[model samples]
Target: MSSEVDKGSSTQRKEGESKRSKPILTRSVSQLAVAEAQHLVLWKKPLSTIYHLVQYMADNFVYLYSEIVRNKIFVFCGIIILIGSYFLDNIEGPHQALFDAVKKNGYWMSYWTFLGFLSSFGFGTGLHTFLLYLGPHIAHVTLAAWTCKSLDFPEPPYPDTIICPTQESAESVVSFWTIFNKVSVEAICWGAGTAIGELPPYFMARTARRSGENLEEEEQSSAKKKVQELVTRFGFFGILLCASIPNPLFDLAGITCGYFLIPFSTFFSATLVGKAGIKMAMQTSFIIIVFTESYLKMVIRLIAGIPKFGAILEPYITDYFEQQRIKLKLGQDSNDGGLVSFLLTCLVTGMIMYFVISTINSLAQQHLIQELKKQSKSESKKDK
Candidate 1:
């Protein structure tokens, strides 16, 4: 009896060791990865469902003009309506004339409002990209763990010292495209389309607020406001068109193009061709125009990076009241030291600018989140 009990205990110990030995590597998805995955989820979801989600997203993200749709309509309607307005501006010219007339008549307030609307339109739809940091890490952990589980699917001793073949092996071409190559791009394309669809009108409204428009009839001409009614319908169509394509790809291409040189010059032409096919199928001409016309945009962007901007101001810096001018590189001199006061001056100025910009951005983000919370509460009350 003693021998049998001892044998069972030893077997149980070996099984426990086997289970504990399984995990050889642990990893976490970066915020960028999460953002990419979410875009994939959005694109994979049904059109109607995505439309509803956009509606929920937009209301929380923007101070969309009360002048626009009063109904609890889908968010994409705004994008559709914007596109229609663009065409209307092209053909009927009613909306364009009204806008021009407003500007001519010293509607500087309206003009500024229009610019603001353009800047923040897609902000609502893209706000969800924050899910990169805001969401539960559980989903990410699960994906990592699921991959680890599949490490043994080919049957393995999965040696402890050996990096498992599953971890080291080249992922299939499809996986490579979808995982590393596509994620960064998906975020950019989706974000840009969201911006294009959502920004113009909301920006207009916000600009009015920013410019201190306190009166109701300040710019409302009864005949002119009829164009806004069409704006809602057309905006929805535009958003639908944007949402259909891999919107993230457009942005990804632009940004990555700015930062990187590899596989881009070769792949970019092909990418544009793919995007052209996509936009035409969706009947969104704006996208085709964007990718086709923006060849110099990235080179321009590379020139305008933050570090490059710092370098631009370096030449103007001159050392004061000295026998010989001191040439100081960045971070080489302490501000209190006298040898390179000019460099110190520039450094201090740059630091101040960075702080002020960062603070304002933080405030903007906080304001946005607060606005979203208020909207959510209002929506819930209305639903009840």
Candidate 2:
């Protein structure tokens, strides 16, 4: 019995030793996969989602506005911030003063509303794109609300404002042309910006290989393989989808395109096509809904004719049309005035932006998880 127990114990020890002696090379791939997965999860969410979400909230803004108004804490904090900013703007005491500090940290201050116009290149926090969407829809209200009255801007608004031409006006043809022009310009600008954003990562990879900066051939080979895989898997459709969609992952695709030295023509063309599609869709929608009176009337009628909800929604529907009419006439009102209303708008915008961003982040995480699993399997096969 003692001999049998000793033999069994010895066998177990040998088995354990063999397991411990397994090759580290076999594990590295899985480790790398996990690390890449974690990195992707940590970042690469749709930043543009914040803009779209804000627009969506603005589109379906009811409870959201009231909720913001009802929040005493929010109201108090807002008041404090406003009062403090006002004082800071006037005082200008310290070098790192409150308003200056906020500006330094990328928070928009006085005349900050015009920052939207510059956002066509994905430069700012996407407020401008939202403005681009809202401009034609809400006309002057969206513009006036965002612009600072202190600017004493002018009697006439910016020339590029998205207001559709009146039907009775001969300039309607020009306005129609402007719609296509606007979409094309936005697509090219944004697409170029996105492509430019990819250059840093691509150059870094190239520089590393050229300089042999502690980067192993195997690692470089792996990265190249990954890029090649992407190119093979998605090709033009993949590039187009990423560009068209408000996704943060587009940067990765861009980087991959650069790293592989994809023809500049191909990359630019795909991006332009995708972005143009998106902008055209948005612009056309705005034109149809806001500019075309017949279409607007038909839509309102349809909404009013709905069975159960129509009656309940009738007042809101009518009010919206009336508001649009006033907006078209450029009649600014008290409703668009006051710090309170501005604060409410800001609160609603922020809430919607956050919600959209968070949802996209979750989706990005799910995608990353799947990618990790795929990479792990590939790694495992190579090991075998």
Candidate 3:
């Protein structure tokens, strides 16, 4: 009897152990399956997003086209511009003359000269004029003074001439005031253009609000929520402060202000002051100090002294400085249709396309809703 009881206990113990071990094995397999699924999802997410985007566009293409056609003025203008551009591209003599005329009249300080740069900067993401056009111009001016050891300002259409000169000696000292005067007009124009760019978001938000569309329920990032809160709390001064400091969240501010039904004049005025007045001045001053002094060069030298990456960075840095020097010496503009220019053109095209598509989608949604409402009302009347 004792032996049988012992055998039974041993058998039960073995069964329990097997049961426990089976769960562990199952759990391990499930964990691996989950991990593999996640990995696949990571790879598939972008492709799925693109596929869905294309599908959505395809579904709404008819509505979008109808909405676009309803706006006859926009369609007419677009067609005219396209036809004009094609013809202008083919005509050589007149085109060359027009180009020469633009080159001559569009000097730095001429509002006309900076128009293209201003518009480009305003209309697109990652295509600021400061980095491409104005920043380089300021650097070249500072370097020219430093290398030439004289205060000889270049003629217009070459290097930009400053408005106010305040040097006592022939030796060039690029003062804060001097740099400020040189790039002020261009900066203001660029600032105004940026302010104008903010209008689309504002208008879209306002239109949605007026159309009884609620965007409040939309999921927002923590950062965007915080920016919207700040804009709402502070109003005009809040917008000015946000705009003045080179904040990327200014778009959120514009959207919030528009959704809350803020006046256009107040929002625009504050933005203009912040971006054109304070922000531009700050940027201009920083560039002047960096290029005029040995700070940037010293930093480059320090980086080049690093172990492995230093050697790689040194050549590129040296080449960049050399190119800048050559450009200044040759008195040529930096829009040489290089890789950077090509990239800028691509970015601008993408931004324009995005804006047009978004606008059309919004209009189409509104039109579709109206049509649905009318159809429902007619059906109810027929039923009655």
Candidate 2, TM-score vs. the true structure?
A: 0.41
Worst 10 residues of 1 by lDDT: 322-331
Residue ranges of candidate 1 with Cα displaced over 4 Å: 1-167, 170-176, 179-235, 239-384
In order, how many clashes per candidate?
34, 1, 0
lDDT digits (tens) for residues 240-288 of candidate 2: 6666665444545665665555666677677666754664355444653
What is the lDDT, from 0 to 100, of the residue 93 in candidate 3? 72
lDDT of each: 0.36, 0.49, 0.63
For candidate 3, which ten residues in a row score worst on lDDT? 34-43
| Ranking of candidates on lDDT, top first | 3, 2, 1
RMSD per candidate (Å) reads 32.1, 16.3, 15.7
lDDT of 3 by residue, 164-228 (tens): 22233555455656656755666676666666667766776788689764453334689888888
Off by over 4 Å in 3: 1-126, 160-173, 326-384
Stronger candidate by lDDT (1 vs 2)? 2
Q: Residues 280-378, candidate 1: write the lDDT tens digits.
A: 233222222222213223433444454856446333322221111121111122345344455545665665465444433433443343344446447
Checking candidate 3 for backbone clashes, the offending pairs are none
